[model samples]
Target: MDIAALQRWLQHAMTIEARTSKGIIRFQHGSDYRRFLLRLKQNASSNTLKSVKPIPLIRGISCQLPAGLSLEAFQGQVWLEKDCKISVRPSPYKAKTMDNGIPWGVQHIRAPQAWGTTTGYRVKVGVIDTGIDFQHPDLQHSLLRGINLIHRGRPPRDDNGHGTHIAGTIAAANGMHGMIGVAPRALIAPVKAFDHNGSAFVSDIILGIEWCVRNKMDIINMSFGMRNRSKALLSAVINAYNAGVIIVASAGNDGKRRTVDYPARYPQTISVGATNRLRRIAPFSNRGAYIDIYAPGDKIMSAWLKGHYNEMSGTSMATSHVSGAIALLLSLNPGLPPAEIKAVLKRSMQPLRSNKARRTIGELDVWRMLQAAEKR
Candidate 1:
């Protein structure tokens, strides 16, 4: 059937109680998978992909299923070809980033002083979150072409506003808007793996990391997490780290003592937690041995959706600060590998004694980090 015919059928199709419209499926790493894809490509037209081409990053293919076929039917067909792993995209989960009030986080981490050394110039930072507002004044010029896994043909646009805020924290320009990022000159590659509601599947995140690897991003910022750990997710993190990409993720907002969220807990990522102006860990920030660092995440002001600025708080905000700081490090030493960057950051942190909870490496100190970079 043709694209028009597929669309017409999609609009009216209902199978076993669910709308049979979209699907996300992946094949294992093997030759049979490639052959299957080639066959599918030969038989299918371009429009079958509602938006972008089937991404080679995670070896996953996304498309609107043909008319009269439910998502289950498509999965079954793939299963017939080879024993592989496949997952349907999950509903958007609640994210950790939130509006607090004011933008004091920058000074809390001493980013202004570090600005003299480097503003993350020439660094490529990938934000794997909700899409970004590329037209936002603070981010437009710094944005590189990004992919939208949620909506293929569409540009990675910020309908949810979370990704835009995170991007601003990392690379928003120091312009007339009165807002500045830790790495104001850094390039942002916004990979929209999550939907507007802040939820996404493990598969999308894997693809996002692969895209970052393919683009040679120096730092990839992820401000989302889940409780359960998946083997596939761990493998993806390992792949990115092995590729020399610095992976940073939020520790989550669960506020538990021994639990940090997956991807963050996976060791390959720098698990970040949130701290307030008082230098106390936020009540909502997750804790555990996996928590590698802390940063200002309370009442932090940055870019928002629809050409606006807002204050939000969460471990998500903290993750952005670390990402930007990593970018700043790369600016000074572009060849620094992921391990060295983490080491310098650890050595430079301002150790804090927190009675309220177990601390990780302590609060971020951009000025101190710069000093370490200089010596190296």
Candidate 2:
């Protein structure tokens, strides 16, 4: 079965369960997935593997394999396919926000002053989360045609409102009454990986990243994570980085030092933790060596469902601020590579006053970033 056919079948018949099912598996690449399927077909006589059906799916993923396939058998086969990584049902990071009269996130990031320089025009960003509200007045003008990886047949619409909030923070237009985003003119490419319930498998996220890479997105903001690392996930991040896409992700909300989430934990990506108006790290923001910087996330007001606004908090929100900052930087110097962009961000950050002596870089300084980008 091809992916579209399977998707059509799924849309009409069965729902893909989030957890406790091992029927779904994602491989390192399309060739690896195909090779594994070929092995299954060739070795159909084996007691451990009785099925040999084929299905082409997104980003090297194959889902809804024949029921009753042995997990142990599948694992045994993948263990030998050393070049490939296979995983099932990797959980998603939940959104873990503040306030100035001006909305602390924007003010703390110094976005208003930076807007005097540039509003991130011509910079395209990909928001990889639970879809985005393409029609929200505050964000409609900044959006590009995006894909819905969760339900491949549908338009990428924000059902859970998380991606909308994230998109608004990154690039919502400067309307009369709506809260302004950090980079108000940046274009958002909504890559809906997570379903409405804020849940997704690693495969879903990989597909989103793949779409971002294919479209040559300048930046990608991922506000979700899984505690356990998946090799396939790491490969996807690396691929995007190599393609010159600046990737930013949320440090998980586990509130623990030395335990940031994967993709965030991956060194190629910039991992962000949350801070508040006082320049103090939020208690819920995970810390450790993996956390590259902090940004305003507490009680942040941004576009929500149905053209409304709401305040939310999390490293997820913090991640969007950094993403927007990168967009602004890219708008100034579109040629800046991921490593140089990260270095500029680290150099321009204002250290959190509350965490003095720890040398932690606190909130973003968008104005400073603008100055630095101009030199490039």
Candidate 3:
């Protein structure tokens, strides 16, 4: 059917349904719908029907439609907005007393053993999250100049503390006075895509991925997730992967048995799930065949805002461990591709003690991973 014919049919069907359903269907044949149709026609006339206007970073536009409108009628013609959230626990614990040594997560993953071989020197990790605390002593030397997508003129500094925590997990470096990270020598480039509230649109994330690719980042650490899939986000991820950048993402905190979140669900990313100190899966971690590996994420202490430390838990923490582990691998062999790195990671994992039935997903062993890389 032609576009106009389809629209008329949808309207008629919606109106009929609204009348028969006795208020169950509230079809608003108002300016919103009119504007949407008008934009649709404008896009079609310009031969850019699939692309959303004004926002070049996003490939699709989202709008509310009448309840009875058939989605199949506009198949392949409409794109909806997908909301993304930082994958973190609901509550974060403030560290009352400070400890001066390697964090438990860093030690749990056996990162100290690999430190003798490579401390991930010269590796660049692009963190696309809220932002980072540039003044934090543990992160000051480990941070590189980064961008702020939320405020173009300002620096990408942490406002929500999520990015700072993620950064500390991957690359915090304070030898004597504070805690060290998994890849203490690695540099992190903060890409502020989310706001202070830790909420982000898929477009901002896509833009962040573009920046990482342009900056030639060795690893992209994505500690956020969304339930719905965005084609534009997936495309950006594939492009980054093909550009020889390894992307590590959280498997999500939904605690679902068989479902993972995107872009973690996307095959190009190395999906990580949460594991506690006991080497068992965390209760909040999403698990399935898509989880590439597990890492320590339960009550793990890391850098917070204002040069302090705190304990947080979620698959986001798990993802940072994997990203840091990859940084160590890349420091040894910078030429290794994403596929080979993923293979080495998978082959070097240790079996989880709690969930043995699903042997497909295993816990990360950083020392073993580096050893495996040497053999390759």
Best by TM-score: 3
Rank all candidate structures by their TM-score, best first, as comma-separated numbers.
Answer: 3, 2, 1
For candidate 1, give the lDDT.
0.74
| lDDT: worst 10-residue window of model 2 | 79-88
Give per-model TM-scores: 0.79, 0.79, 0.80
Task: Indicate the TM-score of model 3.
Answer: 0.80
Candidate 3 residues lying further than 4 Å off, grouped into runs, are 1-95
What are the Cα lDDT values of the candidates? 0.74, 0.73, 0.79
Please write out the lDDT profile of model 1 over residues 140-172, one tens digit for every residue.
878998899778888999778889889989888
Q: Which pairs of residues clash in candidate 2, taking residues 3 or more apart in a chain or in different chains?
A: 96-313, 97-298, 97-299, 97-300, 97-312, 97-313, 98-298, 98-299, 98-300
lDDT tens per residue, model 3, 96-157: 34575788888988999988889999899999998999999889999999899878889998
Off by over 4 Å in 1: 1-29, 42-55, 58-102, 356-360
Number of clashes in model 3?
1
Regions of model 2 farther than 4 Å from truth = 1-20, 23-59, 65-102, 355-357, 374-376
Better of 2 and 3 by lDDT: 3
Model 2 shows how many backbone clashes? 9
Q: Candidate 1 — worst ten consecutive residues by lDDT sum?
A: 80-89
Query: In candidate 3, where is summed lDDT lowest over 10 consecutive residues?
Result: 19-28
